[model samples]
Target: MALSFDGYKLTEIINPNGHCTQIGFTNENEPDVKKRGVILFDRQIRYIEVEEHQKFKRVKVYTTKDAEPMDFDFLEDNYANFDLFLRSIYNQ
Candidate 1:
């Protein structure tokens, strides 16, 4: 499966510091949030990436619309790889 945000395909993860929040909002009446980009991973692997620089567990996943306002803080808190993250999510 593939996920795209604001015309930007979920290709690589962004720096989780002050960069993830760089995504701005639209000028619509309600000011909708616009995403800067997206982080690509497998539904079964749940690895987060920023150019193969790092890998981590998904820990938690949520619909972008209902997720915390531009919060990717979890990206900085977890790092389970080698199929571990994926395995944890499925309990398989």
Candidate 2:
């Protein structure tokens, strides 16, 4: 599937378990220009370029009450669990 961002074309890589990996940018295409990171979306736009070519960041959550940042937990393969995890993150 085509995922476009700011007129840039993104290639989507789907895992066997149905998770998606959208490659948003590459420094090589810009001829060795130092790139900060890449944009990607799974269930949502959970990232805005990677940090230091390593860390994956989720979209920030804003709520009406005190919410503590929770540790990233890897749930075993299940779409329901995936939805739950994503929902919980946003609810925080």
Candidate 3:
């Protein structure tokens, strides 16, 4: 995949793991970076993918209220639950 921020373009490929997934970002023909994270729920299950970069960031991709599989639980009540979830996954 190609990721562009501002003007710099970053390309990556999807290297799926058994459970989680990995992204190989390439720049200037060299391995620019490696982003390892978990795909907790795909669009099929929850209509969103939550990825955390181990204390760096917790982001929800392709997220929309209508696309949500069910009513938002953790976000509606305990926002901390999401943080805890990320921590647990990263620790494992």
Q: Which candidate number maximizes lDDT?
A: 3
**lDDT accuracy of residue 59 in candidate 2:** 25
Tens-place lDDT per residue, model 3, 1-49, is 2122222222332334334433222234334543322233233233345
| Poorly placed runs, candidate 3 (over 4 Å) | 1-48, 51-73
- What are the TM-scores, per candidate, against the unseen true structure? 0.20, 0.20, 0.23
lDDT of 2 by residue, 8-69 (tens): 22222223233433222333455554332232224543232211212322323222231422
What TM-score would you give candidate 3 relative to the actual structure?
0.23
- Minimum summed lDDT over a 10-residue window in model 1 is located at 18-27
Whole-model Cα lDDT per candidate?
A: 0.31, 0.31, 0.34
In terms of lDDT, the poorest run of 10 residues in model 3 is: 1-10
Better of 2 and 3 by TM-score: 3
Report the number of clashing residue pairs per model: 0, 2, 1
User: Which model is ahead, 2 or 3, in terms of lDDT?
Assistant: 3
Relative to the true structure, candidate 1 reaches a TM of: 0.20
